[model samples]
Target chain A: MAGLLRRDMLGVALTVAAIMLPVAGAQAADPIKVGVTITQSPPGSVVQGTQVKDGLEVAAKIINDAGGVDGRKIELVIEDTQGLPEKARAAVEKLATRDKVVAITGEHQSSAALAGIEVAHRYKIPYINTNGWSDVIREKGYPEVFNPGNYNSRVGAAAAATMKELGVKRVVSIAENTDYGIGLAKAIGEALKKIAPDVQYKYETLDRASKDFLPAILPMRANAPDAIINLMLPPAAYIMMNQLYEQGVAPSAKTWLYDGSGLADYPDFWQNVKEAGKGMLVFGLYHPKMAQPALGKQVGEAYTAKTKNEPNRLLFQAADSLFLIADAIKRAKSTDSGALIKALGETKYTGTRGEITFSKDKGYAFNQWLDVPYVTFQLTEVNQKVGDSALVSQAGQPLDPAKLWKPAK
Target chain B: MSGIDVDLAVNGLITGVFYALMAIGLSLIFGILKIVNFAHGEFYMVGAYAYTLIALALGVPVWIALPLAFVVGALLGWLTERTLMRPLYAGYTSWGLMRDEYAVIVTFGLSLFLINFVDKVIGPYAYRGPPLVETSRVVLGPVLISGHRLLAAGIAIAVIAVTAALIKWSFWGQQIRAVSQNRLGASLAGIDTAKASVIVFMLSGGLAAFAGALLSPVINASPDVGIFPAIKSYIIVVLGGMGSVPGAIIASLFLGVIESFGAVYISFQYRDAFGLILLMLFLLFRPQGLFGEKGREV
Candidate 1:
């Protein structure tokens, strides 16, 4: 009787061990899903979307090649928002519930980002803003949302400082009718008021849909400002720049053409602007001359090798976005939403650009990678590459006016 | 007037010429079908792409490419009428039997399809057309205009004159007018009413496409490039008295000058608003429009 009882106990223990081990193994091997929302069609900036998509894909490949995080692959579930607010909201909802992604990232447009964050907050999912520069995104103070790219206030201060250094008393910003464009335009105005009190500044908001801006541009001919700042995205920015050049408005000896939209890095810049881009000062987010981590070089080289086009700032920002998510997952040791959010908040990961860490402070600084580096450069010749352009200002440094160029009328 | 005002007026008139070209086609479509072609903008977009690609990509001369673009647009217009638009008036003996709602739904759907088709196939990139002239800048008294724009405006005037003449005096022109006035009566009088409808669509398509090709140099061609022009065309069609080609021409010029001057004197931001205000004022006071006759036939 005693031997029979011992045999029954041994058999039950063996059965339990066999069932539990395989379940744990399957869980460990399952891929972790991340969500990406970007514009892939018209009425939105497709160029930005294509760049971000390429960047994320490159980073995903790098991670998988490095055996991924804890031996599980990072799978991206992408949705095309077309840069519409309603589309973005639905995309986040689908990503969180249907795709069951651990986190959401790669939103480049500010208006889309604003809509996306609401859904992320509702679902308590982690959202990393890749390129949406509007300060209002960070100002909302949503715990789930984080920004690791450039912000409007940063640009506003930088632009104000540059204007002061150039000693331009009168400035005009031809802004596109969008959150990013108008926000930066207003931010610059505020910054100018504080830092360069004597400088005269005003901004004209143009409909993004309207192709003709001659009316707004022609009036400036009679009383041309000292500097004309572009606060619009291409191809609208390209159109505006060409129109400005055609009207003898800027890049001339008397007036400087300052690009606040970081338009120089776009692949189609020279193709669209041609001679109009010459002698223009650019607010560059990623210059080839700037110091970056080894990962940055890897991603940039991979992007060029794949696309056969030079790397832009959006690539590094997008790569860093994905890397931050993967790093958070590894640190948390789980794919649970609460754990992922907590891990992301406490992240201090070395990414493609630099050692990225979220800020604990409130307002625009909260959960933002505050020290995103930038540089100022000048396009001295038509069809000049961003790498070949002269860097007039380095990260955290003032612009050197002597290094700048203006076309002689 | 100051030099700036003179410059504004000159630019306004030039713009008006292009607007007249676009509006004439839309007016013709409305006159014949009594339903506005919602896809009128896509026709323009197609022409812009055709001209740009033919000249820059295929190494064709600008003069040759310009006419070829119009031909392409005319062919597209003909095809659209033969296929999608035929169902609206097919087998229907009278205007009252026609499903007017079908025209709206089909044209709107067609517009969306064409925009997306171009976007996907051609990719969402803007291609700047080659300039008709090599000179970059041309000084015209008080204004500094680009050589391409000045030349394009000249071509636009000639095209408008030719189109107007064709509609007024040509053999096909008289048939189109007769059909537009009374489709059933024109059919009864031995005029092939369907053929006249086809010609109107072709002419409308050709003119709109020509306008697009002309402006491609200034406004780079993208997928949805026709949206703004299409909206303006709607307003112009109404302002000019729905079906009057000459009225369209005059209204186009008037709106252009008002917008140009209003943008400068009143507010640049409200430049579009000025046109809307005019439209509202006209709708309230003169519902029949500048040239449109009062009352609709049941």
Candidate 2:
């Protein structure tokens, strides 16, 4: 009886070993999967998503061309977030659990990023934030999340500095009713208090979906402020600017139209706001005059060649996100999530933007690469490209107020 | 008060004129159909896209694009009536048996479908329609306004006036009024109630689209742009006494002025809330509205 049982156990063990051999061999040869969540449809900013997707694809191609990481191809598993938080959460869950991606990336909006990171945290997956600017995303202190994109605090400080340089006493911000908009508005107010204590700061939260902003802008006509800061995205932002211009409010000799939301780089910026965009000061994240890494130039050229449009800061940031993930995968030598997360923590790769390195500090600095390059540029003429615009400042340099031009009344 | 007060009032009135153009058609539809067409905003969206795309893509002049938008909207209205709305009125013997709940659900679904369809097909980027005039800004005494806005307002007034006149004296207008007064009685009197409903829908769709096309230069064309205007139209429809064209015009102007003044004096944040608060008060106190006649059921 004992001999017969031993023979049966040996036969079952041999069958299992035969099955495991092929599975193990296939696992070794399988591709490394990276998850990307982006808004490809309405209610979300599809423009931002399309740019990010292009940048990511370019970076992936670059990586794949030079012999994929450790003999395994980098596979991008994309899911559409539709710019909604609930949808983002579900996309992340599907990517993490169903697809078994090594890392999650390509979230553009802050609200969507905020929701996605929660699921990434649950599964201990590394999430490379593409363009979400809210500080709350960092404040969460999730170990698995990393932000290579711009932050609201940085933009707020830059805006406050510009306002102080311009010597504007009263400032009003027309912010979209969103986490990114409200956070940046508050950050700007706080920064202003520290630098220009006498400046009066206030912001009006407008619905992003609403077309009519005359009701909101008309009230400001009575006592237009010294400066008007736009902290909203396109379409809505363009409408608001036009209405303000039509009302003879901002961009006039009295009030300065300062854009901290980087509207000048948008492809439709000139087409939408022809007259209103002139004499506007823009807080730009990328300028052609600024020093660029070889990777950035390559991606920019590729992007321009494909879309026939000038490459913006988002393209560079998005490209760097994918590049960094690929670099980590190469360094880790495996597609295992644990290995990728550890390698991302020690990321030392130079991406299209700069030498990307995740910080060890907590809060907003957690896994964030500090000293991301930025510049301030002014749109001196209508339909002027970002490359042709006058660079007022570069990467922590003070903007020369004397170089700025004001409109003639 | 300073000169800014006069500027604000003029600007507010001009905006009120545009709102009235959108609301009057919705009011007419509610008067006859007795159901709020939630898809009313999509009609505006469709018109804006039609005018902008036709002018920009096909290189059609703004003059031609404006009327073309109206025709497109009218066609959409006709299609909506023939397909979705027919289920509500066709083969129904009694008004009590009419399925209003189903109409609301179907129209709401249509609104969602149209918005998503446009977003997917045209891409999500907002397109600013070409202006009628190249003039950017014009200063008239104390008031300053955009040339496009002034031109659009003038067109809106003319359209509203013509629409009002048509509804007042035209043969089809009287038939529509008769149907709204008593659907069963009008049917008994050989007034094809279904045909009257179809005409009302076409007029409603055309007016909403015209408003959208006129404002495309100022607002830009987007998928969800109609949502706000649609909400405003609903409020104006109720405040203006459901089916009363004159009442809608008055209510739209009143709401616009109130919003403009309240935004400045009170809080710009609560600008949208003022309309809702007024709507609540009207519903509580004057359910029949300013011009709606009280009705009794047998």
Candidate 3:
């Protein structure tokens, strides 16, 4: 009787193991879906979107080539936001609920990012902001969101410091009517007030959709400021810059044109601006001469190999964004949102740019990689590449006026 | 007037010249078809891409590429009229009730199609067309302008004059005008109304495309680059008079000058709104527009 009872229990245990083994194998073989929201088409910046997409793909290829995280492949489910808030909200909702992605990332535009984070927060999914520079994104204090990209305060302080070093008394910002543009404009104002109180600063918000800016620029010709800061993005920024140059308002011997929006790194920058871009000061997050980690080199090489174009800051930020997600998934050992969020919070991973660790501080610093490096440079010639441009200032260094070039009126 | 005011006026007039280029084509289409062609802006967008790619990618001379853009746009307009617009006129007489709805839906669809098609085929990167001249800045006393812009403005005035003359004197233009006045009467009078419609579409497309090619150096040609111009064209069409060519030209210049002055004096932020406000006033008070005759249907 004892032998028969033991044999039956062994038979039941064997049957259970047979069912569980295949299930485990299938789970290990499954691809981990990461949601990506970007403006694949305009009226948003498709250039930025394309760059971010390329970077994410490069990072994904690297991860998968080396046998993806914990024996599972990484699959990106992308949705087009078209840089509209309503579209972004819908995209995030679709990504979180419908697609059931583990995490969401690759949002470059600030207004879209702001809208996307709300849906991510409600769904309690981890969101990695790629290149939205608005501080309000961090100020919202959503635990689900993590900013591994540049923020407005950092650029504001940099621009202000550059202005102070250049000793410009009056500065004007031609900002677009978007959160990123307006926020950075205000941020620069705040920073200038703190560092150079005597300097007069004002920003004019322009419609991003409008093609002409001659009217706004005409007034500047009457009594041009000492310096003009560009807080707008292309192609509006390009038009504004051309108009500014045509009106002899900025970038002249009397006034300087400082680009706070990192427009110099764009592939179409020279093609669009041409002579207008010459003698312009740029607040750049990535210069070919800047010191980068091994991971950065690897990503840059891979990107150049894939695209034949030079690697820009958005590429590194986007790659880092995806790498951070993969790192969190590896540390957590699970695809669950709660586990991923917790793992991401305690992240100390070295990404493409550098060792990225999220800050615990509130406001703009919350969950942000605070020490993202930057440099200041000047474009001295028309149709000049960013590599050939003179680096006026290195990261964590003061601007050298000797290295700067001004247009002789 | 102050130097700035003179600057504003000169710049405004130049801008108005380009506005006239876009508005004239739209005005012509409305005059003949009596239904708005929503894809009018896409014609401009296509011309922009055509000119930029021909000059930049194919290494064609800017002068040749400029006219080629017009030809491409005209071809597109012909094709659009042949395939999409014919259904509105063919196999249906007195279909005025469905005309507006059908035209709207079809043209709107075409606009979306063209935008997405260009975005996919050429990619989303903006291409700035090469300037006609290498001179960056041209100063005329108080006025400062790009050499390319000055030349383009001059070309625009010439084009507008030629177009107006053609409409007033050309044989096809008279037929188009006849069709505009009374489609049924023109058809009964042995005028090839369909041919007239086709010609108007082609001319409209060509003119809009010409404007686009001319401005591509300044605007940077992209998929959605035509959207703003299209909006401006719409306002000008109404403010000038829906189907009056002379009215469109006058209104275009008027709107441009007002916006330039309003931007500096009133608020730069409200520069675009100034046109819309004028459009509203025109719609409410002068529904017939500056030159449009009220209750003129035969």
Candidate 4:
């Protein structure tokens, strides 16, 4: 009878061991795959893409090192859109269907983002637009989409305010022939009409793909505008700046070259533009001196360690995108598309830049970070670091003329 | 004319010169091979990268780098003709019915391959080639121009003249002309038609590459930088009369001036459209172009 009892106990222990083995495997859980679409090749701004990728990578490492969200490591599935709309659409579609990413994020170019979001909306996957500034993006009002980055209207308002502060009567905006460039150019004009009615604002749309802007720019030299705002991205922007400077058009005593594209923050800004960048006012989203969250400081430090490059606005935006996605996953307690979207909608997490919260208002503010911090700084000398540059305006502050630098005639 | 008008003309003329350099090569290939080289733009791209990288990375002088870029482009063209173009024409008319379609597919595939290959290898960053002259600006009368632009414009004029003279007087040039007029007849008459095709391709590649190297500083060497120039060259080629070197030069200048003036008075957004519009009008009215022969010669 005792031998029979020993055999039964042994069988019971074996059954328990079998049951616990599967449970332990389930507890480990698979990595939560997130899709990222960025411009990794030409015709798109690869510089921006590289920076965004590094930022996402840095943030992912930090999250995984901290044991990941809800014990599932974050995995970024990056796709190169080549800065083309069709490619972006295809990339998002492939990521959503084939890769089975839990969430999609990291679209930096506005044109590509505009295309990628449509696919994300159709699939009902949560999309966090990292840096597309086009106002039309939010106006689409996709419930699945969230923007924690800069917007065109905010830059428009800031540019208009600066134009008023500088007391410029005539402003010409040379914008790229794209949704971001044209939309932002129009927004600036509207803002100018409301704020400073006396200002004469007219915008010229140049094909971003076309390398030569001399035909468009030469006409400007005959009647130089008070302030020539750059609404284009590099390397086109760099070419335009060089040509303008070579022609003695802007950044002179008579005219101010105000950059609304936040160009100075780019890693290649100084190398490409050289002396032309001097005395040019930049609408900056990030500065070394700006106040950031503890997480922001940590991410910035970690990014510098990884890329050996100074932290820029896109870096913070990209980091915040991943953090928000991770935060949503934690709140939802599941990676279901519907649950993640709901969690992202109610996001109030403190990210790298500030305490992030998305507004539900229509137009530019729809699911957008309404209080995105920005400042206006001018490069006073060649190869000037963002820290060394003079900041003429701070977050929610008027322009300080005393700190503004102008090129001597 | 106002100051802007003169500025537009000068800039237009300079731009036209670059367009002509690119178009001449495409014209030559069409004259000899009777096939549209869709990979022509990539040849320009290769040249731009070659010039920029050699000067920037290898520490070579800009002048030497410019010629080296041309040589690289010529070599690339020769190799492409040998490997890709050889298969298309070998069994072409004698056995195959899809020679035209095959040629299109092969050249198009070659174009995509080169673009992606370079993008992967070099990384997608644009590099500005060092200018021949360090001086930034050179004022001429009322209009102001960059020193590099002025220097490049002069060099282009000289190159075009040399290329035109060579094609008109040289033995190889006469042989290319004969092959273009009657390929079978020329082959029967003891002219090496294949050799003429190879020579045309090399010359074409060299000229396009030279143009790319010259404008690298202004345009900044990127993978897709060739696309814009290639489009302009296509329009100029058709407008000037395909396979007509002089016609390409004249049409390129005309198109450039019209585009410059049109951008200012009409719309800068539609500047590129002007060429397409002119191309359409020419296609409708003058199908043979300014200097093209009335009958198609195979």
Model 3, A214-295: lDDT tens digits are 9999889889999999999988999999889877887899999999999998998888888788999999999988889999
Q: What C-alpha lDDT, on a 0 to 100 scale, does residue B146 get in candidate 1?
A: 88
DockQ of every candidate: 0.64, 0.62, 0.84, 0.63
Off by over 4 Å in 1: A1-26
Worst 10 residues of 2 chain B by lDDT: B289-298
**Model 1 CA lDDT for position A266:** 87
Model number with the top DockQ: 3
Best by lDDT: 3
- Residue B20 alpha-carbon offset, candidate 2, angstroms: 1.5
CAPRI classification of candidate 4: medium
Model 2 agreement with the true structure over A1-409: per-residue lDDT tens digits? 9999999999999999999999988876688788999988777888888889888888887777877776667788999998999999999999999998889999999999999999999999989999999989998988788888899988998999999988888999999989899999999999999999999999989877766687687667768899999999988899999989888888998999999898898887887898899989999989999898898999999898888889998899988998888887778876667888899989888888888888888777777887788888899999999999888887667877778888888
Q: Determine the C-alpha RMSD for candidate 3 after optimal superposition of all C-alphas.
A: 1.8
Task: Give one digit per residue, the lDDT tens place, for model 2 in B1-298.
Answer: 6676787688778889999999987898888888889999989999999999999999999999999999999999999999999888787645677888898999999999999899889977888889999888888887778899899999999999999899889999999999888888899999999999999999999989988899899988888878878999999888878888899999999998888887777877788889999999999999777887666333
Off by over 4 Å in 4: A1-28, B91-98
Question: lDDT, candidate 4, residue A354?
Answer: 93
Tell me the TM-score of candidate 1's A chain: 0.96
List the TM values for chain B, per candidate: 0.98, 0.98, 0.98, 0.96
Give me the displacement of residue A328 in model 1, in angstroms.
0.6
Winner by lDDT between candidate 4 and candidate 3: 3
lDDT of 4 by residue, A1-409 (tens): 8999999998999999999989887766678899999988788988889889999999999999999998889999999999899999999999999999999999998999999999999999999999999999999999999999999999999999999998899999999989999999999999999999999999998888888888888877878999999999988998999999889898888899999998998876776778789999989999998888999999999999987888999999999999999999899988999999999999999999999898988888999989999888889999999999997888668886656778888
lDDT of residue A264 for candidate 2: 90
Model 4 TM-score (2 dp): 0.94
Instruction: For candidate 4, state the interface root-mean-square deviation in angstroms to 1 decimal.
Output: 1.4
